[model samples]
Target: MRTPAARTRAGSAALAATAALLLGLAAAPAAVAGADHRQDATTLDGLAHRSGRYFGSAVDNPELADTDYANLLGSEFGQTTPGNGMKWYATEPRRGVFDFTAGDEIVNYARSKGLTVRGHTLLWHSQLPDWLSSGTWSADELRSILKNHITQVVKHYRGKVFAWDVANEIMNEDGTYRDNIFYKTIGPSYIADALRWARAADPKAKLYLNDYNVEGTGAKSDAYYALIQRLKADGVPVDGFGMQAHLALQYGFPYQMRQNIQRFADLGVDVAVTELDIRMILPADATRTAQQADWYGQVTSACLAVRRCVGITLWGYSDRHSWIPAAFEGQGAALPWDEELRRKPAYDAIGAALTAAAVRRTG
Candidate 1:
């Protein structure tokens, strides 16, 4: 295996060049736009049109200048989300100071392009501003703040966003509640409260409990199952489960994961493979790359096998733009697209899975 530093340096060089090329062409005259681009012009668009679903990507504000990716994505997926922009930190950096301009720009852009919009999250532990996490606030105060934020944000986007990640990453690996400030202060009931408030703010939009590592059975998944059962029994407003299918080449594909997904659907909720990517160490040889492809195929097959799995969004369009490389040392080329914006084996694998035996409907 290549060292993480070596891989980062190599991957960084490749990604930098790719980013530069994309940025440069974005500034070029519109007439020449279609002449030199490398992305498969028809691939994503064709898949989305045929599948009746949407693909998504995260965007940095700077990348917004290069509308090529967005244009390409919109053509195919016809749906967009902040990816990270709508998170608690970006939306509300200060206690009461809400800033939706950045996120709103992305949402408005998607809408203008005739695309459906999904809000990335309403509640999450990551990317939360320091003040919210560190401030000395009473339990009641925290609950009040949380309720207000959810109500305000959901109401603001009412009728526009097709779905919202109402409560994100709330459960632990053992499926027990992750102890966050919200959970600590407001207790386990905060999840239900957030969902109820979101529904009250926008009754029409679908609300989801989003998390990573819940795609397969284990401690974390078991916890989610119990939580969902309790919430359903209590008549909480959770309508969907956002499975962040962040996979790795080495880990065995969670084969029985569909059974868990079916259980959720049985409770009358939808399941979406949200923010998916399969990461592998850099200098990927042919065999390692093929393993990555197989991992993607297995995940997509699971989603297709489970009936309630309605949406599958690659974490990003290409490895060049993937966050995993930076976030996870040595983990590069995590997505279906290669450095030059070309489709990899993983792309073909997913496409095949989607077209696989008619998806088995559950619940």
Candidate 2:
């Protein structure tokens, strides 16, 4: 999971210098163009924002000004979400105290721009208010409180949000359940209960179970598969699965990651490449950066090839504002857009993959 923090004064200075270099590169036409650039750019841009899209991102940092967001909205990208807006802590910081100001602003902004809004998360272990963690309430009281929170928040944004990650990162990486407050108080049944409450609040919204490390063969993925199968067998209202593709360059990307996605899609649920990003060290090496670009191309192509994979979103817009630098020590440059907001090779590679998909569709 990615965490955010203020950069150290020294780190900030280094980032500023890097940003200047990126800005200069972004302004250079030669850096922006190459063989088949125009055609690929057009196709990539079109497919990127097309309906049933291949690309998306979260709005977390203010560095992405309104104009920046406007430009992205005007492109082929048609979906937008507050990466952290719908989280439990961000929405309800105090007991029975709801704050929808930030989330409302994001939703209204995206809707006004004619973009689809994905409500990031209603339940998760991370980002929960401190109050919720303290053992103060009985099981019944906690259940009621949980229900009310879901009902109020989901009702508030009822019709606007296209989908909601109803439960997030509930299972551990070792195929067991994580011992969170919800699990301890409400029991394992809390997962289904939360989803049921959310659906009752807003029947129209698509509900999803979201998590990380479920992109490849592992205990976590296996656990998720079994859970989904059981839920479907019992007729649970789970509508989708959000595969949080937070990849690291050192891991060499997950082997047969797309096959894992296809397996989830086979369970008859829509699949989304949620929270996708690739991270690497600072003063990025050219060879490794190229490898990152190739990885992006491969990931995009895989999603395009699978019809049920409806959306792909970067955790952040650019390395400048990426959560990587602050969250993961010694790893920073991790997204398709560079620090200065210039399109990186990975950006072009993603565009090329989308362009190729669109060509195949037309051909």
Q: Write the per-residue lDDT of candidate 2 for residues 1-363, one digit (tens) a residue.
A: 222221212332233234334333223332121122123234343455443464667776253365554455334345666877788888999989999977887787666655568887888878889898764888898888899999999999999988998999999878899998888887988888888999999999999999987877789888888998988888888989998888887765675677888998999999998898988766699867776777777677678778788878778667766788888898878987775656777766676566556667777
10 residues in a row with least lDDT, candidate 2: 31-40
- Candidate 2: Cα lDDT at 41: 34
Please name the candidate that would achieve the greatest TM-score relative to the true structure: 2
* C-alpha lDDT of residue 215 in model 2: 75
Q: In lDDT terms, how accurate is model 2?
A: 0.73
Stretches of candidate 2 exceeding 4 Å from the true structure: 1-45, 49-51, 61-76
TM-scores vs. true structure, each candidate: 0.84, 0.85
Query: Whose lDDT is greatest here?
Result: 2
- Clash-forming residue pairs, model 1: 173-220, 174-219, 175-220, 175-223
Please give the CA lDDT of all the candidate structures.
0.70, 0.73
In the predicted model 2, the residue pairs found to clash are: 49-76, 49-77
> Model 1: how far is 200 from its true place, Å?
0.4
Q: What is the Å distance of residue 362 in model 2 from its true position?
A: 1.9
